[model samples]
Target: MLQVFVFNIPVESGERIGFSTTLLLAITVYMTIVSNRLPDFSYLDISYLSNFLLSDVTSGILLIICVIQSLRFYHAPVMQQFPKVWVPDLIVGNPYGSNINLAENGRVVQFTNEGEAVWQPANVFEMNCVAQIAYYPFDMQNCTFGFLPWGFGVKDLFFNVVSQELMNIYFSPNGKWEITNTRLYSQIFYGDQLLRLEFTFKRRSRYEIINTVGPIIILGMLQVFVFIIPVESGERIGFSTTLLLAITVYMTIVSDRLPDVSYPDISYLSYFLLSDVTSGVLLIVCVIQSLRFYHAPDSQQFPKWVIYITKVCSKWKQKVSPKDKQHINDEQIVNSDDIHVPTASEEEEREAPPINWPMISGCFDKICICCFTCICMIRTIVLFVMLTM
Candidate 1:
């Protein structure tokens, strides 16, 4: 119920998601081979990569990642003779990796008379990558899987990408991110040939938009309504102050989500929040101005500028449209017989009260409500446009 009241996102009636072409999920791209540094050989296998842990994927700790891989080798006659060579070792290709962790230690799987061998084992690696969060919530992350021969240098062992196709047959899409693109390439790194698989993922923005941005925009527009609340009710300051505090709390929430980085990069969200805070402060100023005018003693007569403004506004108000004038005339003509002429004393008694500070304050309230409401709404629309960009 709290979620529905505070953060529910309403989708347009005709909104829909459509895909023009069928695409596969990421194919598992895993390789952890270890053995005696003997001869350069080509091995072929299909890898399955899944279970992306995004919560702690940042640089808070030097965490090690583990992957299970299935390996296959063909036309290796010498491996059949030396069963001792079948032993699996260690390999860490990630540049930020600290060490290699081994599990199941590469046990021999199958051997055929045709000189084909299979080994399946668990490979663990601890890696640390610097996070780029300047565009958070609307950010795209680039993660890579780089694997190469550990025992042999580029001169002895060669690596190549047989295909750049990522098999998506066994993978599920992430709830918060979508894989935008992928790349495969072979490169020589630190004298070792490496096969690198790169993944570009973009975050889904619906959560932040509905839960954070929506509230900011709504509260921003709501600030203007403080003027509409009658000052006589004594709720104007309380309402404005409460709104200012709410905006401050949301500012903290936005700040907490951002990382403290050594470099300078500002999120566009910061701009939106800054505008909201400014409006809140301005709202308090406006409220104070309105209250001051309302409470002023009648002895403190209106300034010349104030009197002039009210005179101009009254003149403008007296200039009625033709439709209103005709309606008034029709009513008067129909009720001519019922209308009783007022005496001079009655006219004097019915005269409007003298122009006072309280009446002027009411005028200022209308102006502030219209002006601030327009500003808040215009900026909110701009925010939506920028968010899409």
Candidate 2:
């Protein structure tokens, strides 16, 4: 038989003491059960059991709790109060032992115990990107994303890039850009240690070449055809003006698609701009040439060189046979039925002119054709060099 003594106590105190006693009893029972299930000491592997309990079971449980909490309260804002817990700050001589993982919103940093913590809950981010466009449709670019602890000094936390392969594997491919290379680096920046990831990408030229460059090249080539139209047809100026306006509209569209950068490395756009200016100047020259040919009086005296060139260009003209000349005279007589025939002195006056205005105009057209052909060839060569480079 057992004798028991009971003491009266406050309700809250008794509850707390009972709860503590119950927890101790439960732990003792668990240990006894685990010990009974174990094999004899001579046959048991203590190292395996110790590892399983400490590293696998305990750490796994804690990791699971961390993941769940992170997901459940990911949007919660964290605040820190003054008089914070002090941590040691130290710089890392080597970063091989650390590990880094990139998250969607930020980076996950794991440091070895060799370094001291300068501060808690710091953030570094990538926000600025500058693009080079000198090559235009076929250009390459390098961009960087970096991070460093905000409040931690170099001594408190060491920053380093653990893996570039992770970034390369996760990078998404796009129609306009192709990833070429990825690199990881670490350096001290403004007294803070910075870990940087750099990505190099090249522009895919197929889309731009097919959609933008092809049409522009065709238009540039067609500009040469404007000079092919006869000056007397009254369409030369109008056609050139229309082509100029079309080019201007296309330029505006291209400009709108590009970023507002001071220097876009694309040579194609500059080529187009230069082509437009050249076309405008060509049009002006054509207008002047046409005016000179049409408005010049038959009595106007041309330079000796001009007369020679005109005569040479007109060599293809068939000499008038006597029979054709007679026919021409008969047609003139019939058209002037009420007019008296010209005297010898008047016929001699007409024959005294050395240069014919109509012949000189025809020669000018031939010269324009040759000049425009040469310009087109030069433009083609330049474009080839630019695109290839």
Task: Tell me the deviation in Å of residue 65 in model 1.
Answer: 48
lDDT for residue 12 in candidate 2, whole number 0-100: 34
* Model 1 worst lDDT run, 10 consecutive residues: 17-26
lDDT score, candidate 2, position 311? 60
| Residue pairs with backbone overlap in model 1 | 25-168, 27-167, 28-48, 28-49, 64-126, 65-125
Predicted structure with the largest lDDT when compared to the true one: 1
Q: The CA-based lDDT of model 2 is what?
A: 0.61
TM-scores across all candidates?
A: 0.60, 0.56
Cα error, residue 376 of model 2, in Å, equals: 2.1
Among residues 3 or more apart in sequence or in different chains, the pairs in candidate 2 whose N, CA or C atoms overlap within 3 Å are: 89-155, 90-155, 90-156, 91-155, 133-265, 133-266, 134-265, 135-265, 136-266
Displacement of the residue 123 alpha carbon in candidate 2, Å = 12
Model 1 compared with the native: what TM-score? 0.60
Q: Which ten residues in a row have the lowest lDDT in candidate 2?
A: 1-10
